[model samples]
Target chain A: MTAAAEFISVSKRFSRRAKVRTLAGLAGQWLRGPKRGPDGLLPHEFMALQDVSFAVQPGESLGIVGPNGSGKSTILKLLFRILRPDRGQVVTKGRVGGLIELGAGFHPYLSGRENVSINGAILGMSRADIRRQYEAIVEFSGLAEFMDMPVKDYSSGMYARLAFAIAAHANPDVLLVDEVLAVGDAGFQLKCYDWMARMRTSGRAVITVSHDMYAMAASTRCLFIKSGQVKAHGDARQVIEAYLTDLSRDRHDPVLETNFIKTADGVPRAEIKSVELLDGLGRPVTSIGHGANLMLRFHYHAAEQVHSPIFALTLFHDDPRYPLNLPRHYLFHVFSGPAFADQTLKGSGTVEVLVEDVRLPVGCYRAKTYLFERDGVSPIFVQDGVARLEVDRPDWSDGRPLLEHRQRWTITSHVST
Target chain B: MSPMSITAELREVAGARGLAWMLASREVRVRYKHTVLGIGWALALPVALMLVFTFLFTRVAKVDAGGLPYPVFVFLGLVPWQLHANILSGAARCLTDQRNLVTKVYFAREALPLSVVLSALVDFAVAMTVLAALMAWYGIAPGPGLALVPVVLAVQLALATGLALVLSAANLLYRDVQYVLQVGLQVWMFASSVVYPIPRTGNLKWLAWLNPMTPILDAWRTCITGAHFGLAPEFGLAALISVVVLVAGWRWFRRMERVFGELA
Candidate 1:
């Protein structure tokens, strides 16, 4: 048998102003343009889906993992036929059902039972067919008592339950889901994930787009999409590893390139461009071993006069919600003077703050920069979300501590019988 | 999903009469529930239209329904015409009316129109009952063709359903189609021989013959008029047209089914 779904070199190019062009272009093709037709007559074009091809066989659940705006949802839409492809074709060999958008086919005025029949039909069921499966659909939706009530009266969870019940009970050969588990409460999310797992076991080809790595790790077979293209198309574990590595690399740049933070205005606001955690001799440091010296390098450029500027660095965990502020002992004070040294200072300068035998917990952290005048006015410039650093502490085979650090973690492995 | 595989699923929608009855009852109950006169409105509508047309055509225009009282003739055609008009229009916009389920689940797409048609059938039956009472008051004895009314109505329904499927699918992609159909139905009601019968003319009769509704409505008039209306030929052609439209609509719907999820 042919594959459950096949995308053959399918590419969709969308004009930036396609909507405007479509409206205006139809009005008059009778007019000749001076040079081109008209500037706004045709919109700019860009490819949303590239010349990508993939096949999903029966009993395979493919997880699409990618960065935001990497055409993950577009793939699901193509499979669902929500939008026609501009190029190539998507051949589906089986009945296709989608939980693409929740509560899509419901009528506010219609009762759950009435909507179910209509919804079932839209999903390719007959009236008689929906009637036969009516009880099952109602039970699954958990709206047995409320079946007679109109859908407008349903709560969001009830709406999702009804929607999910309809899509799942459709029993289609191919299932296209996009972040369905992203809705409702945690319990409902888990329920949907469980249903997906059962669907995978039933030999139905399932294409799911999700950001939840744990769910992908548990249920999917082929992890195919990472940042729009197929990073690892076979093993789920390997693909996830590759995706995570890419994510880490993106967050932590190796070159330690200087990124200046400007004031609210677009002018060359701050004197110091950026400051990054670098190793000895000004090399970028990432995942430094516990017993190594770490240096915080400051790259500064003064567009105009700098008056008694003070550079301050604060360390905290990566999460801003509840940052674990570093102990003051971890701080290595560098050059302390009349801030910018002189009110006439106007050139580029590099300042390094070094900490020897740097030891912290094995985790990722962010370094914040603040610039202030010697008069103790509020810091003129504060830049955040700029830089990140990772600390790695090696461990032994028996789960015992291996790497030497000023502070040590004591633990004993209790063998449970 | 392949159309062949969905047949079993489609058949199950109509298998549960209770389910159909529940939906049908909801439509009926809701319409009359808040009304002071309840279902009297259903009877009053046709009676009122008949009286108005009877006065205007008989007294004002000096028109006649082949020597029969204008009220009775108009009433006969109006009963079936109203049902046909309501079902066709309602079912055309049924899918858009029920976008919630279409976007979410896998169900038979035909059920939306089917239920609306089913609900309107209840209204048709209620109107027919009032027609029976009016015929009795006028001492219009029953004829042999009276028994065939249900069969004639069934054919009318199939044609309406076929039209509904096409319009419903079209309405999903184009808003103007539904808007146009709403205006077209009123024009179509007058164009067909619903109120006044058109004398047999060269292409006029043929034009009426081409309209699937012409034969059904004409045959309905003949049934009550006790006239020899050779409706068999027209009915056959209309039935054929209904089937063609039905199949064409289904094919178009299936072809475009995949894109529905994306666009919708």
Candidate 2:
């Protein structure tokens, strides 16, 4: 079978700092001699993609999985010819349709109906083809009532729906999808997935870049990239497992070695001395697979006799840059209750919380332990990032970890065929 | 491997002609939509400029218009000048305005500037109709020289396309190009014989001839007014300059095309 797209030892480098933001800056840089380094990059420049080779034949779906700034999107752009490789060749056989970003070619002032034709054309569809599929596009978007209105008037959801609808109808031989599936409501996302599955069955090639693990697992093949290089590539499940292990190992270094001290002010009624994340077998481990039992053990010391102390452990995803920005409820959990009601702790004691079936996805998470008085309002001692927990699940057949809900269903039938 | 020849680059653009037309029509529709004047706005600019120039030059300054009616002469020159100015200014910002598409989607980048120019042509067509009506109102009969109007318009298009390509590409690299082009266009208008006849006996005469637009604008006035329309050596020079600028600008644009996505 012919390949829809192929890259041969392709490498791309970008300046670490954009020196051409202004005309004056560009002129000044030109006056300076020999700014490039030995790698043909200017000083402080770095490689975005380094000697990466991949191919996707007809009827194959290739999923590119990587963390942010890992060159996954750069590969898609190179395949679409938006960026040229510096050291190698990229060949795309037939028409390429890209749904790389939400509403990429849409104009705000044009009507949703008009934008469909224009955006479709931009994605390589002919005017005649757009006309033929115009009704289907509008129907699929479910924006027929607002088709005549300018897109600027539509809500953001409506705009994204129309953009996705038009791109879905372009029907190119190879489809390149970025994280656009993360947009819209769950129902629309399911529709997009169904459409993609249909395309796959119809023998069209697909290259997808997504952080969603379930989507990657569903593809025919997966590539795990790190720091502009392919770390592993093969079955989606195995590659995702490798990526998760690498992520946990990278995150474990700081938390596992350092001893955190409780810094909250008060009379120091009690202090968290140590925290450990153990696996199902009770062995101290940094990483545990999803749906496996894990234990959170906190060692604490009391200054004096304390009654009804509250112990709380909150989990946080270990994204240091933009922590606590997104909805933190799922990644954060508070385990607070009456610890030893009517009992007194004079010296040191251990508090163990058994968490059954850890359903968190494959990523590094830090646990924060807090000890409070009986009121559970005022904290006596607080330890931030006390322990690191890495949840890994190689099997994504059940669906996304966050979206998966376990339930039991049964049906009784009277008639038999 | 050989470098991409100009013919090959042009053929690549031609392959995306459908997309260019769709984008151009979208621009035309969006610009005129929800407006009261509705494409009358196109003619309104040149006509308003004609009234202002006629009042200022003929009444206030008492400038000569070569014995032609000031309104007709100024209106004719303003028509093509307005077209050229609108196209250049719009095309200059075209890539910047569509930076979203430039960074996220892949298409022939020329489609953006070319579509802006094409959309301005629709406005030019509307303005031309009003100019023809004004000429009739002034009782200026058509002459055989009117056959050269297409040639004159073609030359003007060549000049506009060339400059638009160059300005749009430069504007993408440096935002200062847009501001510079705005100021430069004001000076270019005055030097192109839009208000007054070119001075026949001064150092400025050669300066006017050096501006390719001067002969093209003069040719437009001559064709409509039934004046002497013989092909002068200056006209040949203007045509040659327009083609050279067009080819050179296109080559430069293609050379810089690879970086536009990064810069935008």
Candidate 3:
């Protein structure tokens, strides 16, 4: 069967600056004589998407995952015809609907009932179509009582619901949804997800471009793109796993590039110079399965005598959902017993932490090591990426768990006489 | 880019005309919403301009009215002039003003300019009612030439639609076009025979009739009095020019629209 929507080797480009050509600018170009680049693009033009291709079958939801400036939104805009592809053809079999912008054309002065008609029309529905769907749209939005009030009077959540209701009722054969679900209340977002699932079951194609890994895993298939090229495609969970692994790898680059404050008061305080994750045999490891012994080693140096210095180690998953809070959040933290104020050191040395049975569930985890004040509260030196850890899902495990808690349940039945 | 594709795109745009009409109606409704005088504001601009010109021409310039009431005479000119000016100014900024809609949504982009034309039509309809009231107050009766108003109106609409398309797309590209258009229209108004009596036959007639609006404004007044109104013979030229402008403007808009989102 043919795909509901397909990209056939599509390529799109943009100038270094947006192509705002005034008469004077055009005249200047004319006088200077134009030159073309290797890709047949004008000078200062760069290809945003370079011959990338993918498809979405009917009844399939495809999620696209990528970093910023990764040409993900460019694909949606090309498919929606807001931007035309410069090189290849983008084919869609039926009416295309975009959830790219919700409540975009709404006029503050217009009532909700009135904005329905205009917004519907702006979404490419006809007057007759809007009239037919008006009742259903208002009913689904759950704003039936507030339809006559000015849109400005509606809360932001109410506004999103109404906008979603109209676009959902547009009943498109292929929908291009671009991060619009990130807005609105959680309950409303779940409702929209339910609606999209229903549409998928009814044989509609949905292409979602979002950073939500969980949402991507829920799709039938996924495409992983980076730097204008396809890195991986097919099997939503696998694609998402690949994306996460690559993201953690990229996370290591910044740490190696970061310059740590190695000295305090022009004298070296005990500081962690390097870190390594080791196994039972003292071999360095990039990853290992759960339920195994793991060792963490920290290399340190000190130029002067330090009293009761404490070392802090912490572990956590790198969740893309909370980009700003990723590095600072810690799932578990531990400190040396030297905080009792008895231990003192004044030379280079190594410290080792070992766990007999690792309980971290299957996920990518980064470890951060810091040198704290004698009180073990204020950090004197910090390193973001001391070690990168991956906890693999064992063959016996049914599904990935947040924690590998060991538990058993016992039940006894007593007959009542 | 080909002729065939142009026809196809135009057919699609025709299908999206309903979107344009809805947006236009929404604009008209919003303009009147929560206002004290409401539609009175629509009538205010044309009437106020008519009063100003009446003062300028009758009291200051001491121009002859040649038997027609000065207020009635000037308003007849204001009706078409206002529609034309409103459309040009409105269309010139429609794309830039609604950059959010333009960049994110995909519809007939011509609809942006077309909606402005439609909203201006609403304002023009309101202004025409006041013109009728003014005509009644002056005791001027309808004549056989009243039938010719639709013809004059059609040519006027064609010109307005043509210019609307051009101004909107041009403004998106240059941005300077928006400011330039404001000053251009002001000069253009003085150049046309909007408030003065047209010379019958002379070098001054040549200068006055050379402006395309001269014939349109003349035809509007002569159509009221049931006169031949064909002396300038520029009506045929203006009609031809309107058609040329509309087709050319449409082509120009289509050529520039593919870049509107990225650049605008």
User: What's the lDDT of the predicted structure labeled candidate 1?
Assistant: 0.67
Clash count per candidate: 40, 0, 0
lDDT of 2 by residue, A84-200 (tens): 888888888777886787676777888787888888889888889999999999999999899989899999889889999989998988899998887788899999999998998
CA shift of A335, model 3, Å: 3.3
The alpha-carbon deviation from the true structure for residue A1 of candidate 2, after best TM-score superposition, in angstroms, is 4.0
The full ranking of all candidates by TM-score, starting with the best, is 2, 3, 1
Candidate 2 or 1, higher TM-score: 2
For model 1, how does the per-residue alpha-carbon lDDT over B73-192 read when each residue is reduced to its tens digit?
788878888898888788767777666555554344566667778888877788888777777787777678877777777788777877777777776766566778879989888887
In candidate 1 the C-alpha lDDT for residue A364 amounts to 64
Q: Which pairs clash in model 3?
A: none
lDDT of 3 by residue, A1-417 (tens): 999999999988888865666788878889998689776888888789988899999999999998988999999888787888887888887888869999779998888999999999999898899999999999999999999999999999999999999999888899989999988877998998999999999999999999877677899999999988899999999998898778876864346322334565764456777877888788989788766777777777766555776766777665454432334555545566453266565677766766556655445677788876577666767777667777665545544333333221111121211
Pairs in steric clash, model 2: none
Q: How close is candidate 2 to the true structure, as a TM-score?
A: 0.89
Using TM-score as the measure, which candidate wins?
Answer: 2
User: Residue A40 in candidate 1 has what lDDT?
Assistant: 25
Candidate 1 CAPRI-style tier: acceptable
